[model samples]
Target: MASVLDAGPFFHGTVAALQAGDLLTAGYRSNYRPDIVMNHIYFTALVDGAGLAAELAAELVKGVAEPHVYEVEPTGPFENDPNVTDKKFPGNPTRSYRSVAPLRVVREIADWTRLTPEALQMWRERLSALSANPDARIIN
Candidate 1:
């Protein structure tokens, strides 16, 4: 069976917030929409070492899986403005796509490599084939 991963409730919260009049900007104080909510979902899955982004992409293409989602709100004071909030912003002032690629690789490799001998062998062959294709974009 194809594995399924859900991005969890945070994404739902973000969607609800958007529907409820809260703006969903890519970063703070900036208006940017995302290409897909699944990007964030795949990111979390990779971070938690659940699955590869490619697997997520495949599942997405197959229309048989749901990816993780997250809700982001103003977590800190306005940039360069001291009178913005009662407390200082504890983290980065601007939002960004956190570490995603490395974690995804970890999960994909782990999921396929750490297993029964049969799966390992299969993965080994796949890896060999992949290695032979030097033109393959490792990052993609």
Candidate 2:
């Protein structure tokens, strides 16, 4: 059996409009690295982290969606996300995880913090620079 890594009132951030009981699965294109399709569905224990993700996702897609954070429950096993765990933010400070199984949406978190205009611009520039570099990797 797969070991339990976290007992979470986990949250997923995205631009996709979803309701309670909606399932989020892998195989969707990544919000950070738009060039690749992610094999695992990513979530975080932090509400702000999820909000950040939702912001990036919404902005990166260029108005295709509005930011939304949803409380979620993983259907099966999950593991720490290497991209942000030891590799980027050591010791999982981000409290981020990924799973191949579907995540069930519990409800929308309506009050997560949204980025200020300056912060949003900073991220926009940062993402542009990261995508420009061939060395920038998403441990996919």
Candidate 3:
């Protein structure tokens, strides 16, 4: 099962978020081996928040997404440009934004959101069964 360590070791909020996101993503990836399908019980433990964790989990299921980069628009006129003198010239202002693109993993996220207490118990039981006997198929 996943564990949540104390956040005190990290002082900054951004750092904590990055660390959390990275660790969560990496941990999820590590479990998808050919011989083993990780049970929901462990996933439940790793989830920090119902919505957020579900979203992140879904992405992990789809594998890593490509990074996106955008170009920032120029604020001031360029010194070498003849357009600088053109009063009619409109500034080509642009801003760059990025997101974890290609969120195909979102499909897996539904499992967490749809989970009820009973479902959680079932997951725990399945995990226990799997642990007790790796060769046993707990689910069809």
RMSD of each: 19.1, 1.3, 21.1
- What is the C-alpha lDDT profile of model 1 across 28-47, one tens digit per residue? 11101112232221122122
Model 2 global lDDT (CA atoms, 0 to 1)? 0.92
lDDT of 2 by residue, 1-140 (tens): 66767777899999999999999999988888888999999999999999999999998777677999999999988899999887876698889999999999999999899999999999889988989999988887
**Pairs in clash, predicted candidate 2:** none
Clashes of 3: 2
> Of the candidates shown, which would achieve the greatest TM-score relative to the real structure?
2
Regions of model 3 farther than 4 Å from truth: 1-112, 136-140
Cα lDDT tens digits, model 3, 1-140, are: 43432221111001112311232211122121224442211211122233332333333444343111111111212121121113223441111111122111211221223446576457556545655775643221
For model 3, the local distance difference test gives 0.26
Whichever of 1 and 3 has more TM-score, that candidate is 1
Residue 96 CA displacement from its true place in model 3, Å: 31
Error of 1 at 137 (Å): 1.8
Per-candidate total of colliding backbone pairs: 3, 0, 2
Rank order by lDDT, top first?
2, 1, 3
The candidate 1 region of ten consecutive residues with least summed lDDT is 99-108
